[model samples]
Target: MDTTIRQQAELATAEIAEVAAIPLREPGTELVALEAAPAPVAEAIRKRMDELDMTNTQSIISFGSAAQAELQQISQAMLADVKNKDVGPAGDSLRGIVSTIRGFSVSELDVRRKRSWWEKLTGKAAPFSNFLAKFENVQSQIDKVTDDLLKHEHVLLKDIKSLDMLYEKTLDFYEELGLYISAGEAKLAELDATTIPAKEAAVAALPEDDKMIGSQELRDMRAARDDLERRVHDLKLTRQVTMQSLPSIRLVQENDKSLVTKINSTLVNTVPLWETQLAQAVTIQRSREAAEAVRDANDLTNELLTANAKNLREANAVVRTEMERGVFDIEAVRQANEDLVATINESLQIADEGKARRAEAEKELEHMEKELRETLASAKARDASSDAGASVPTA
Candidate 1:
């Protein structure tokens, strides 16, 4: 969607086009024919064929891409390498063929060429026949090497392609997995933002779950909350009662003590002190129960938060693990691509360079060969001239 990506896409398209135009021909057959030729004429025909041969670079590139994929898997394997790096090997092989092409140039062909004047000068002489033998041997050596290089490349390319396909599927898996992780993270953030406070609020409302606890406990908590509310109301009434009673007690204090003197009873009134004690105890228990109600609310809220946190943490762990796997995979794919390109380029360059050097050497060899033939002819002429004068004596 962005400019950089768009540019890359365009470049890929152009590359595909360029590679498409490059033909991938197997040059070994021609080389073999040249080797199998018994004499100069047959070999010359084969040479012409090779000279005219074309290559399909695009197909080679396609095959090279496959090899790249295989290398990726092999490089990233955590397990016993059940899979191999087919692409790297295959590409190397194919590129080697490309190298072979450059290595055996037209000069090499010329180096092996029949001297154009051989038919006229030597006909089928043993020396001429001997030259042909040596030529054929060299030709066979070149063909054998070429065949091997091409054959190896073909096998490797197929394997690399298979690996490449698997690599693609692996990458797709990571992409989908990453999306799930991203979504999960977003959900985690939302949960964290809302769950803590929401759980607290839900518990405070004396919700149905709390209302169901032990049935008896639920009733007690409700009773406690209600009593607190009611006591506040009751305290209003108690205020009036205590106010009136307080005035009376004060009045009693103002009156004579002998008439109001209290009597202690062991049998019927000994427990009279228990009334004051029991009233005080009941008041204290109500206050404790009220405080317990608020504590229950907080504890329930905390329990829910702790449970939710556990689930969230588990979910996050899964996402983190998955993301790490994806990251590893993504890096592997990127590196594979880089290696693939380098391999192809290096192969092409090697082929081109080898071809150039071989061509140059072949040309120089051709020139030397021509000079040797010419000098030999001149030497023969001199020998004939000298022999002419001494012919009688030699006989």
Candidate 2:
């Protein structure tokens, strides 16, 4: 009989132990660790929790309620921040800068290549020099503005990324809390369905048989019943706590989801749309400025061409007048003939002097020859008279 009671008590103790272990056997779920969140976000949550008196509270219900309220406030603030931030003016400024750059680029390319005829002739760069100076100034301004815009964009994107991370962390916290609450509720339900019924059956069966009524057996049975009852009470308390926290957890989850949706809309839709529109506006402004510059260049070119045409026409008219009035006549030809006449007169004078000298010399020569012939004749006559006398005597 003792053996049978001992077996029955062992079975009861085993059943009670099993029932008591149900809640403890649940997997642990927890909120997102504060350390995992960004420092600024973590600090903000800490400040909010402090304001709600959550840090010192031992009541899970109170803490959950306070946290939910804080989370809601944070969500609202984030949404307001996003909604109220203004980037339109910055975008307009960027557009203006880009337009100026485009205008300068177009003007530089056009005017530099299309120098006026006067500009080319005089080798003066006044027109293009002024334009280049203005172009450099505008380019510098564009560089500064673009640098500033990039810096601002970087900061804004960083802030947005941080906010997105905070939202995700908040979502994780609420989801984890919800899972914990759910698991707690399931443990309670399981205890009610299985543990409580087994204990009741064991208690009811205790008085059914006299053989089960020994003093030690009854004490053991009573102790087991009391322990089972205590376990049920503890589980009930846990269930109540979890039930009380459920509303707050669900509230936070809903609020977090809403905030996430808003943030995602801004990141994917609103911000992108704004950027696209700004780009289109800048493109349009640039195109308009370029077109205007082109028109101005065309007008300047036409003016230059017209002035060149006028100058060419005046030069052609002068050439025609010079040709028609014999301004190109050969005065040198007449001068050359006058010089030839003077040379011919000098040559004739020289020839006449030579002829006169030659004639005089010829006459002198004839006189000398005649004088020699006369002398010879005299000597011959003398010789002949002498010879005749000698011959008359000697013959």
Candidate 3:
């Protein structure tokens, strides 16, 4: 890692941490009460109870009814925005961007080379340009998305503030409902245990004519108490709704905060790291290409030198041998001279044999002529003797 780049990264991380840090409330100092009420809750209940006289049951009933309406409004207002929101799509988009970044490869940016000698020596710096163009394109997408995320962050921050206000108001309504319910229960208990019983006794003691009026008054008081009980029940139900809203508001706010922090981290840290790593990858790739070219050149040079040396050795050997030799070798001349002498001897022997055969044929012809002349003479003598005998006698 470069010193400057490392420092910049450290600085970016620090900035992200500082910017994203949130101030937290101390443990057990929560404002919303779920189970147990504190001193303030007790005081609020007592004060609400003091506002209504037990004899005026109508007033107590009115108080609970009003509280019920108010709590319902608070709960509805707090949950209005919560019901329509979903954070899933935003998370999906972020994940897709992260996947795209993860899928990036330095190999994709490499220029394909034919690796011929000329191409190696005069190769353009296309790899660097290719890497730069691709990096810029990726960075551009990230920048556009980050810009959108920043806008979303601002909107989410505003929403957190809005939810905070709604949460506080909901808590107030919860406590108010508690006050209404507690006071209504106390008034109901008093009427059931003491007031109603006493009224019944007073009516029973009245004379026949006055009993009807006292009984009617007792019935109205009982009706008022029942109405108050129903109102208190409604108030408690609204309070339950408010109770549920508190956590929902908090959950939405926390989700927005988490997304904001993630956006900040991407802007400050992850993007810069990508740039740094990509540059390093390109640099390393170029160095490798250069080293390969040098190695190939050395190997080619070695092969050419080896081939030339072998050709030179063969040419030199042939030329030197030709330069040292006679035009006609003595061995070839001696073999041809011996072949000519053998041909002369064979011709003389053939001529002598032909002359001896001619002389023998001439002697044989002279002897054959002499034998023919003697045979002719003997035949002539026989013919002459036969002729003489024929002329002399027939015996």
Query: What's the number of clashes in each of the models?
Result: 10, 0, 0
Off by over 4 Å in 3: 1-43, 46-86, 110-133, 205-217, 237-241, 306-395
| Per-residue lDDT over 235-331 for candidate 3, one digit per residue giving the tens place of the 0 to 100 score | 7776777678778767776787777677656656776787678778878877887988998999999999999999999999999999988988899
Q: Which stretches of candidate 2 lie over 4 Å from their true place?
A: 1-67, 73-97, 107-130, 180-395
Query: Can you write out model 1's per-residue Cα lDDT over 1-395, one digit (the tens) per residue?
Result: 12343243334344333422433221111111323545763544333323211133232122112323443454466224434432344345335433533443322222234554865476644432443454445345434433443333334333333334443443433332222222223323333466434544555676677745545444443443343334334433433343344334333222212111111011112222333443444455456557778988999999999999999999999998887685458778999999999999999999999999999999999999999999999999999999888866652
Which structure is stronger by TM-score: 1 or 2? 2
Q: Give each model a TM-score.
A: 0.23, 0.27, 0.56
Q: Quick one: ranking by TM-score, best first? A: 3, 2, 1
RMSD of each: 62.6, 28.8, 16.4
Where does candidate 2 clash, by residue pair? none
Please provide, for model 2 over 9-44, each residue's C-alpha lDDT reduced to its tens digit, 9 standing for 90 to 100: 334333333322332112224333444546765555
Please report how far candidate 1 places residue 124 from its true position, in Å. 22
Q: After the best TM-score superposition of candidate 2, give how far the Cα of residue 158 lies from its true spot, in angstroms.
A: 4.4
Model 1 has an lDDT value of 0.43
Preferred candidate (lDDT higher): 1 or 2: 2
